[model samples]
Target: MKFSYDYIKSGNATCVLEMGKERFEFYPTFHSDALGDFVSYLASVHPLCKLSWKEGAFHKINGGITWETGTYLLRWELKRDFEDLEIKITEWQNPMIDRKGDSQLIRKVLEAKCNFNEFVLCVVKELDRVIKQRGILGYRQEWQGYTFPIDGFLDLKYACLYKKPFEITKKNNGTSLEAELNLLMEKMD
Candidate 1:
């Protein structure tokens, strides 16, 4: 699986998810920092690996994007068994559902299974490219609603590289991951 996001305008982006031969694209509006929300969701779930003794066997997270006609939701379901992780991606279309828990008679746009780590790495690589192209301050100026979620992005990247789930408390407390990412970004500038 491959994921990438492209900034289209001041407050809009196109997120693309490619799984083997299939490619799905979504247009997410910056109603409340769409990229931040999406990355935060990923960071929240990245710690749920079965290898982590404190984590669970199954987990689910949902995120929504405003499409041209209706709202499109990407539902991520993660199931882990011992050493394997399976990620299920389901896209739904509904005109009335705008938030994560909102439910209705939705149209199923697509459904597929993909690798969890690969998906995370793809997003990490793409986001790194975006940050390189648009500096951190520039991203905040263009993204508008909220600043880029460097904390979440770095947390996930560290987890992927080290092959371990990051500590939620540390991330929430702005300790390890946030501090390291801040120092790295400062060095870059």
Candidate 2:
């Protein structure tokens, strides 16, 4: 699995998620902190990695992102049970239309089981690349309406690097990974 984020224009970025031959692309408009919203969703869902064994364990992550078209919205859903991670992408048509008197239909565009660990790692690596390619201030300049989510990104990165889910409150300390993370954070700042 691979994840990428590229700034395409003002207030717009193209993001891609792919595994093997299947690739899905979506545009995230930073009109009102969309990047923060999506990252927050990932941070919220990722803690499930440590709780995948709970009985009757079921988890879902849902998010809506506006597309560049201004008329279409992409609905993203991630479902996890045990070691299975099912991700679905659907197109919500005519979001501006009132649903009170009309029927709205959504079309599923992509559905696949994305590996949980791979997905997390791919996101961390890609964001790390973006940070390195574009400095911290550059990211803020490119991604308007929000700053780079370093706290969430570092938590996810530490979880992937140390092979343990570490929340912001319980960060891994006194380790090479911590040193690296701190250095990266400094560079970004």
Instruction: Name the best candidate (by lDDT).
Output: 2
Instruction: For candidate 1, report its TM-score.
Output: 0.66
lDDT tens readout by residue for model 1, 60-131: 444432333247655555454444445555556553556664465455546565566777778877777777
Q: Model 2 over residues 1-189: C-alpha lDDT tens digits?
A: 778888645778888888789888777776556555555566667763332223212233455433432456676666655556677778765446444523366778888986777777778888788888887788888877678866567656766766674432323333355654674664321
Q: Tell me the TM-score of each prediction against the true structure.
A: 0.66, 0.73
lDDT of 1 at 140: 81
As a whole number from 0 to 100, the lDDT of residue 83 in candidate 1 is 41
lDDT of each: 0.61, 0.64
How far in Å is the alpha carbon of 170 misplaced in model 2? Answer: 9.8
| Candidate 1: regions farther than 4 A off | 48-105, 165-189
Q: Would you list the clashing residue pairs of candidate 1?
A: none
